[model samples]
Target chain A: MNILYTKNISKSYGDFWALKDINIEVPKQSIFGLLGPNGAGKTTLIRIITQIIFADTGKVHFDGREINEEDVRKMGYLPEERGLYKKMKVGEHLIYLARLKGLSRNDALTKIKYWLNKFQITDWTDKKIEDLSKGMQQKIQFIATIIHDPSLIILDEPFSGFDPINVNIIKDEILKLKNKGATIIFSTHRMESVEELCDHIALINKSNVILYGSKQDIKQNHRSNTYTVDYIGEFRNTNGQFQITDQSETEEGYIRSNIRITNDQSPNELLSILIDEVEVHAFQEKIPTMNDIFISKVNEGTNA
Target chain B: MHNIFLIIQREYITRVRKKSFLIMSIVGPLLIASLWVVPIWLSTRETDQKTIEILDDSGFFKDEFIETSSLKFEYIQTDLVEAKTEVLSSENYGLLYIPRINLDEPEGITFFSGKNPSIEVIQDLEWAMKSVVEDIKLERSSIDQATLDSLKADIDIDMINMTESGEKAGSAGVATIIGYISALMIYFFIFVYGIQILRGVIEEKSSRIVEVIVSSVKPFHLMMGKILGVGAVGLTQYIIWLVLSIMITTGISSYFNIDRKDSLPVQTEQSGVIEEEQENEFVAEMFNSLESIDFSLLAFAFLLYFIGAYLLYGSLFAAIGSAVDNDADAQQFQLPVTIPLIFSLIVLTAILREPDGNLAFWLSMIPLFSPVIMMMRIPFGVPYWEIGLSLTLLIAGFVFTTWIASRIYRIGILMHGSKVNYRILGKWLFMKN
Candidate 1:
């Protein structure tokens, strides 16, 4: 079941189209990655869903109905250019945000206490936001994003200012939130995190969605029928059974080579040919990494 | 609506809790109270009486010189040289040497002193000598003092304003003062409170908190909340000032056993008992004129115009704040918004000069100028329909400016590091959200 989706979303700023004919669905209780390069209209699309800005022509459906101000309350948004009132205390700022998102004062206080204790920063609650360091502020912002217990949480560049340890903590929290049944839209240029956590992703390029689907399905579709083989010595007589796509030497004197199977040849046949030619150590299919797929797709867009 | 309230609460609480706000609240009443009490207090304190020694060679002015509280005249029998030495040696202020001359054309009446004598002293001495010569001349023409005194007429014209409710006693001086003061208060409040709105908007935009705010609530709500919040701060300060000022003034006045009705002439009596009678008459006339004014209507109009003008200008200031990244960038936009306000101030004297004139009518009809100009006319007894029409236009103007400002504000807050100009602001006004 889809928790939120956009249909035929298009937006323009004068002559420049920021988004065009965009469509995506965020499934229930799953991590969704919204990947795009700088100025590729990702923020614009996020704003539309948050109702900060209007789309020239589009409809955003949350749960079973069209998105409204009420629905916006059920969704939490942490913008990329996020900030808190410097003069306000951490507890006050969080409570203000939670109340703005439709939580009662008591509920906001309880949730804030719970989150602060969970993050082990309960002592920092009374301190001003300006007094906190950047990493601390990032954690506070992260807590603010979900303090209202929103069903759909959108975090833009959520890990930008966090250290590795905090990033792992946040990643764990995100996974835990998902496990407890919340749909997450994680928008960022970082592909490694998308690979690690995102169950689904939509890659936008130049105001268009260039690639989108389940992570497994996309990785499957981009596969070029290639496999890597690690061997001790190079016996290059394949008898045209496969084509050598790339070859390199490992630091441990292992010949690491990649080969694409020829017409209708399965992995078993390729492995049989490789064993006969050299002392085979390891063999594996070469599935493309998200980073590689992103670069290539973006490059193709630029070239086109 | 709830989000707007939260925004307002935050804005108001943050500002009211500030050190500056506390300082201003305490200082504002003292300043206003001093403005009222200081002049009266100073006037009541006795000034040093300067004694002038007169060496009248004509011998016709010996009895004419009279002593007043601030100026005393002493007739000396010595010659001019001796008088000068005696005046310099003594603690007298100056020596007045009156040379005997023909009564038809008096000339060269020199007064010697250590420094330049005040014009009041010189005029006082001259009037004394001239009156003596005039009495002598009248005697020479066979006219008695009683006849001359009876022939002199002192005419006082009581201005009676003819209105639909019959003739009403009015004083132009009192109206001018009231009109000018109310107009100035309106002008002062708009600038002080309007800039607060601007700075608030700039702070949010520069700190990048506006996006997080807009995501939860509408930009319109945020702008209005800020404007109303700052306005509430202004109103609170004004009320505290009013209460404190009244308390201080009453406390001081009662402690000194001073009655407001008798205070002015009593202070003037110490300077010159001769002017005391005239001062009392003028004070009484001013009090009568105050009675003729409808304070309730004036206050209602003031409240209406104050809020209308503030809302009108406050939104514009907010828009300017949103459009710029900092106070430095706001100068260009601020100029146009402030021009009308400054223009009203420049023409305030002219408006008061002829409160019901064509210039006043047209300027007060324009919403930008009406808050100040109409206020100036209100104390002078404006026609009810004219006031109503101006107020309606002002309300309409506020609505229109707020609409334009919100349009620009919603877009401007999100646009950072872009050099904004009037043309770009114009574009943003029409840009879709």
Candidate 2:
């Protein structure tokens, strides 16, 4: 079931349209990646979803109902430009955010303590935000994002400041949240994290969603019918029968090359040709990476 | 509603707990108390005596100059050159030189001192010389000095304001002082606390915490909460200052033994009974003047204008703060809002000059100037209808500015980076939610 959805949403600033008729849905208990290049209206769409800003014309539905003020209590948003009251202590800041998300004071305090301890940042509770390192502040920001345990969480560039170790920690936490049935919508230029964590994705360019679907389905749709084959010996000169896109001699004295099947040939048929001449070490169909697909689609969008 | 309260609570708590707030609250009262108390104490202390030496080359007015405990005059037989040398080198406060001159037209009467003498001293010397020369001229005409002196009776007018009910004693001097003070206090509070609201808004916006908080509450509510929260802080400071000032003033007055009766500089009369009776009458008249001023009404008007003007200006200040990303950007927007306030301050002197004139009447009715000019006119006895009209307009002005400011604030705080000029601000005002 979709937990949050926007229909025909558009936003404009003076003469510039920041977002235009953007329709997107975030399913329950799934990590939804919102992808866009700089100034592609990704932040604007997220702001609309989180109600930090209003959609010039559209409808936002939360849990199958029109979004209302109370719906905000069940949504947590961490904007791309991370900000905290630099003078405020970590513990105090977290508690205040939690309370603003509609948690009672006692509940906020308890949850803050739990999150601080969970992140192993309890010792830094009294330290001001400015005094913490960027990575440390990122951890605190992550904890603040979900401190109130909202059913839907929106994070923009959530991992921008973390080191690799902290990144892994946050990734694990996100997976844990997914396990606990929390829906997440995050935007980032880091495709690796999206590939690792996101189950669904949308690629927006120039105020329009050019591509969107489940992660597997979107990747599947972009894949070309090409395969890489590693073999011990070279194939016979059957250039007309089969096509080798590119070939290279490996250091292990094996011939490795990418091949595209012609004449509606199946993988088995292509394999049959290779099997007769040499020992087939490895063979696999190539699926496009998110980074390649993102670049190609954005370029296609710009060209069109 | 709950989110607004939460925002207010956060704003109030964070600000009240700040070290700056505490320091200002404690130190502001002491500063104000000293401003009132120190001057009075210093002026009341006994001052040293001064001796004036007169070198009369004319020698016609030898015994004319009199002596007082504070100012003593001595007639010395010396040439102008010797006296000039002595006066410049010696510690004498001043030297009075009377050169040989005609009594018909007195000129070249120079009083030399190391520094400029006080206006009071100059006026006293002028009065004594004029009277002595006048008596000599009258004697030349065979007119008796006694008759001339009797004819020089000083006229003292006791102004009484007549109303339909009865004639009440009135004093313009006291009323003008009170009016000036009341108007100035309103100006001070609005300027100080209005900028406080601006800074608070700018702090929230620049820090980027405004987005997180506004996500839970309406932007208008957040703006109102912040403006009201800072106003509360200002009110808190004012209350503490008022109480501390009262305490300090009373304490200092008693410590200095400033008895009203003893402090009254009542000039002695020829008859002791008349002097005592006159003193009692003056005391009663001062009390009666104070009683007839309607202090409760003035205090009520003062508070009403102070809060009304503060809210009006504070909302605009908050809007200006929201429109800009930093102080540098805010400067461009701040001028338009502050111009009216500054204009009101500039015109205050004009209002004081003609408290009952057409300019004062109209300016007092204008919502922006009403808070200041109206208060200025209040002590000088303004009509009730004018006060009511000014108040109504002031409240209406606050509501109008707040409505417009919140609209601008709702859009401005969310906007980051871009030159926010007047055109953009106007566009933002009309932008849909």
Which candidate leads the pack in lDDT? Answer: 1
Worst 10 residues of 2 chain A by lDDT: A234-243
lDDT, candidate 2, A130-233, per-residue tens: 99888888788788889888899888888988888888889899889889989999899999989999999999999999999999999889877778988887
Candidate 1 chain B has its poorest 10 consecutive residues by lDDT at: B265-274
Residue B122 deviation, candidate 2, in Å? 8.0
- The parts of candidate 1 lying over 4 Å away from their true place are A229-263, A267-283, B51-58, B73-123, B133-144, B254-274
Judge candidate 2 at residue B315 and give its lDDT: 92
> Over the stretch B1-433, how does candidate 1's per-residue lDDT look in tens digits?
9988998899889999999998998888888878877776765573578888888787777667777766787877876777788888888999887788778988778888888889877887777677788889998999998999899898989988777877778988888888888899899999999999999899999888888888789999999999999998898888888898899988887776666644563432223564767776777888888977779999999999999999999999999999999999999999999999999999988987788899999998999999999888888899999999999999999999999999999999999999998889889988999
Q: Across residues B251-304, which tens digit of lDDT does each residue of candidate 2 receive?
A: 987998776654565653433476668878888777766655768889999989
Q: Evaluate candidate 1 and give its CAPRI docking class based on DockQ.
A: medium
Q: Give model 2's clash tally.
A: 0
lDDT of 1: 0.89
lDDT of 1 by residue, A112-146 (tens): 99999999999998999999999999899899889
Show the colliding residue pairs in model 1: none
